[model samples]
Target chain A: MGRTSDAREKILGAAHSLIELRGYSALGVAEICRTAGVPKGSFYYFFESKEALALAVIDDQWATQRSDWTRVLKSDAQPLQRLRQLFEETEAEQLAGQQNCGTVSGCLFGNLTLEMSNQTEAVRTRLQEIFDAQVDMVDTVITEALARGEVTVSDTRAAARSVVAQLEGQVLFAKLYNNASQLGALWTNCLALLGADSPHVPTAA
Target chain B: MGRTSDAREKILGAAHSLIELRGYSALGVAEICRTAGVPKGSFYYFFESKEALALAVIDDQWATQRSDWTRVLKSDAQPLQRLRQLFEETEAEQLAGQQNCGTVSGCLFGNLTLEMSNQTEAVRTRLQEIFDAQVDMVDTVITEALARGEVTVSDTRAAARSVVAQLEGQVLFAKLYNNASQLGALWTNCLALLGADSPHVPTAA
Candidate 1:
């Protein structure tokens, strides 16, 4: 049982990095098995198919990201400051990815969503749930900001969508431009969207 | 000469539809040749390789999209109104795609950027060029808006990036949710980003 679980994790980790770097359609089961150093039969034993493995990858990546989000968002910082910290951490993460891979990999969810959303219903719906959850988290933060007079906005939901969408777009630009500095504007534009009066300097990790 | 040009155009047209619907990695040369009704030899005769054909697709699709952008942006409409028209037109296009394929295909450039940016230099640089052109066009419109007092922004270039980024993100969401209506807020958020005073209804086509 221990080895079985270990093999499953190895396979998932391999798929995650491959998909992160090269995208969904380009990588196949054979490469994934070879990368994980697991037998092909073991892969089928763990996952019904490649699509199933991808769904698990999405679920696992989201769980990992959600933990980080919950930590930053639940901190005692002010709502606007919390938002800034979130983006700053994102920048740091992208820089780390660049250090490892020579270019920023952007968001796994955003990358997978764009590549597979139209091609597969299961992946698309799963990604929608992830994004919806993200919006909910952001909406909660925005509502708190409104209560504390940290920001002003007529519609919190639309504002949340804008914040999330802007971040995704910035990451996409970062990937396209191969420049992590392009992501610097995410926090400022986010503050402007939320009607924050004063800009906060990005906190270094 | 005429027959050679026709074969090249036919191959490009087939690739355009396939890549737009499926993506770059999933579609292969043989399928494209079959779809174009051209011989394998003919495909290579016109283009150097699959990557070259994809480059042509990017160039061709951008040419198609830029024409629409120019028509809307260069009209007699006010700057803010023109921007709204652009997003409205984008929404209509996504809806049309959804009607055809039961899913929003999003921006072809964006989709390709996420999938192939890390894998291939030619495609990544081509997409970056396309995005730069788009930002330039938006910057010009924003400059006009600034001159006319229709909008106020400190940095028009950053503002243009924000506009372009927000639209890309919204289309991504539309694709993720498989609901074109998710893109409805693009114009409103864009107006807010530009510091425009009020929302402009999308102009009739």
Candidate 2:
């Protein structure tokens, strides 16, 4: 049982890294198994197909990211500050990824959304739900900021979508230039998007 | 001579559509050749490698989009209105793509940026140049807007990056949801990012 579980994790980890560094369509199960140091048979035992494994990878990354998002967005900090924290932490995470991998990997979900969404209905629906949930979280924060008279927006949901869309776009730049600092604009950009006042200097991480 | 030129154009057209529909790595020369209805020998005659072919595709697409961008961004229209026209036209283009292909094939450059940036230096350098040119064009408009006091931005270049970045982000959503309307927020988001006043209704397209 221990050995079987170990093989499963090894395969998942290998798929995750490969998909992160490259992308979904370019991968093969044999290579994934080879990288995982497990036999090909173990892959079939774990994931029914490469698409299934890609879905699993998406699920796992979202689980980790969602936890991070909830922690920051739900904290007791003022709603505006919470949003700032989200941007700062996002930049930090991308920077950390750059240091580890020699390139900023951007958001895995955003990456997969562009590369896989049109090709697979299953991936498309899953990504839509994930993004919907992200917008929901950001919308809640914007509503809070609106109530406190800290921001003004005619439509909170649309504001949140713009903010999240801006983040994804900036992250795309970060990955293209291999410079994580491109994301530093998100804080000010978000404030502007929401019609909030210019930001205070973010508290240092 | 005319027949030979036709064959080359055929290969280029087929590769462009295939890459736009799928992506770079998942394609093979043989499949592209078959789709092009050209002999594999013809592909070798026109392109040196798959990467070289991708560069040609990138160049061809950019040439067309640059013309469109220049026409809109350099027009005598009010500076901010030019930006609004850019967004409206972008959404229209995506909508047209969805109607033709049953999918909102996104900015071909952005699709490649997320999927191909880290994998190939030649492709990466080419994409970087393309995006830099995009920012430069947008910077010119933002600078014009700032001069007129129509938009307020601390740094016009950074502001241009934010605006372009927002467009890229929103386009990513439009593609994922297969809905071009996701891009309608771009003009408003751009105004917010530039610290401009709430918009007057954009003149009808």
Candidate 3:
């Protein structure tokens, strides 16, 4: 049982890294097993299919990200300040990723959304839920800001979606340019998207 | 000679559609040729490699999209109005895409950026140039709006990048939800990004 779980963890770790580096379509089961240093049989023992493995990767990555997001977004910082920190940490994470891998791998979920969402129903439904939850989290922050009268937007839900969309969009640029600094705009842009008044501009920094 | 060029066009057409449908990595020369109704020999004759074919498709797609953007952006319409028109056209185009295909395919450049940018330097540089040009065009419009006292943004270039970023972000959602209506918030969002007054809100509709 110990060795069996080790093989499963190995496969998951390898698959996650490969997926981040090369995307979903370009990867093959043989290649994944080779990268994991596991036998093909072990792969089958762990994942019934590549798609199932991808679902596992999505779940695994989101599990960690959701925890980080919850901690930062649900922190005691002011609502806007929390949003600002999210972008700061996002930029830092992408920067760290570039330094480690020599290229910004971009958001794994965003990459999968573009590459596999159209082709697979399971991936699509899962990505949709993940993004929905992300927006829901941001919505909670924006609602807090709204109640405090820190923002001007009346539709907090749409505002949250727009904020997440901007992050996804700028992250696309960061990936395209291989420059994590491209994401620095997210905080300022987020402020604009939420229609916050100039009084909060200095606090944003 | 005529037959050779015909085969090239067929391959390009098929590859474009297939790339739009299933993405680049999932496709192979054999499948592209089969879909194009061309002999594999013809593919070799016209293109040196799959990468070359992809470049051709990128150029072809950009040429058409660039023309459309130039026409709308450089037109005689008021600057803000042109931006509004651009978003409207984008929404219509996405909706039309959904009608034609069962799913929304999102932006080709965006899809490619997230999927291939980290893996291929060639694709990365090409997509960068494309997005740079896109931001440049939007910058011109935003600058015009600024001069007319129509928008309040102090940094037209950053604002332009933000606008395009918002478009890409919203389009990602559109594709994820497979619902074009998700793009409807673009005009309002764009206005907010520009710090425009409430005056343009009526015109945005």
Candidate 4:
């Protein structure tokens, strides 16, 4: 049982890494199996199909990210400080990935959403849930900041969504330019969106 | 000569549509040829390969978009109004695509950037060029706004990039959720980014 579970973890890890390096449709099961050092039989034993594997990968990635982000949001620091830390860590991670791969690979959720959302319903729906959950988390953080008078935004929901979108867009740009430095403005621009750095008029939420 | 030109246009049109519906990596030359109603021989005659075809597609798409955006930026309205109109038109266009396809497809250049940037050098370089040209256009528009005293920002370049990133991120979310309405916030958020609705400090340019 232990060996079987170990094989499953290995396959998932390999699948995630390969799909990260390449787009979803461009990778094949054979390559994943080879990279995992698992035979074809073991691959199917763990994942019913490639799509099944992808679903698991999405869940796994989102679970890890959610925990990490939740930890940041739940931290004792000021909400604004926590938000800045989140984006700063994001930049550092991308920079590190660029160092390893010679180019920044954008967020897996965003990448998968763009690549597979239109083509696969299951994946698309799951990606949407992941994104919505992420936005909700941000919304909660913003709401907390507002309660504390740490940030001033007319619309917390819009502010949260815009912040997430800007980060994703910056990551996309960073990846497109093949320069992790393109994300240098992410933190500052996000703050601007939240009305953290300046006074803002209250608009209809 | 006219027949050859017609065939080329058909191929380019089909390739663009297929790619927009699917993605860069998911579509194959054979499928493109079938959709275009062109033969394999004709496809080869017109474009050297799929990569070459993709380059042409990028150029063709950018040229069309550039003309439209230039007209918007050059319009007789206030610079800020022109910017608002640009974003409104974007949302309208995206909604139209969603109406036709039942899913929001986001920006083609951005979708391609997320899908192909790390995978293909030729496509990635072209995407970077396309994105840079877009930012330059936005920068020009913002500069014109500054000269006219319609908006205030410290760094026109950073402002331009942030606006573009926010819009792209909104589109990505719209597509992810299969909800064209996700872009509803694009215009408002964009105004906020430009400091149009609020006075902004001039940061380091």
Model 1 agreement with the true structure over B1-205: per-residue lDDT tens digits: 9998998999999998888788899998999999999898998899988999999999999999999999988899988788989999999999999999777888999999999999999899899999998999898999999898877677888889988998899888888887888778887677667766563432000
TM-score of chain A of 1: 0.95
- In model 3, which regions exceed 4 Å deviation? A199-205, B199-205
Measured on C-alpha atoms, candidate 4 has an lDDT of 0.82
Instruction: Give a tens-digit lDDT track for model 2, residues A71-106.
Output: 999999999999989999999999999999999888
Query: Residue A62 error for model 4, in Å?
Result: 1.1
- Model 3 in CAPRI terms: which quality? medium
Best by lDDT: 3
- Alpha-carbon error at B28 in model 4, in Å? 2.0
**Model 4 misplacement above 4 A:** A197-205, B198-205
Model 2: lDDT of residue B39:
92
Rank by DockQ, descending?
3, 2, 4, 1
lDDT of 4 by residue, B82-121 (tens): 8878888888888999999887878889888888888889
Select the stronger candidate by TM-score from 1 and 2.
2
| Least accurate 10 contiguous residues by lDDT in model 4 chain B | B196-205
TM-score of each predicted structure versus truth: 0.94, 0.97, 0.97, 0.93
Which residue pairs show collisions in model 1?
none
Please, what are the lDDT tens digits per residue for candidate 4 over residues A47-160?
888999999999999999999899987798987778878888888888999999888888999998888899889999899788778888888888898898766777787788
Which candidate, 2 or 3, would have the higher DockQ against the true structure?
3
In model 1, the runs with Cα more than 4 Å from the true position are: A199-205, B199-205
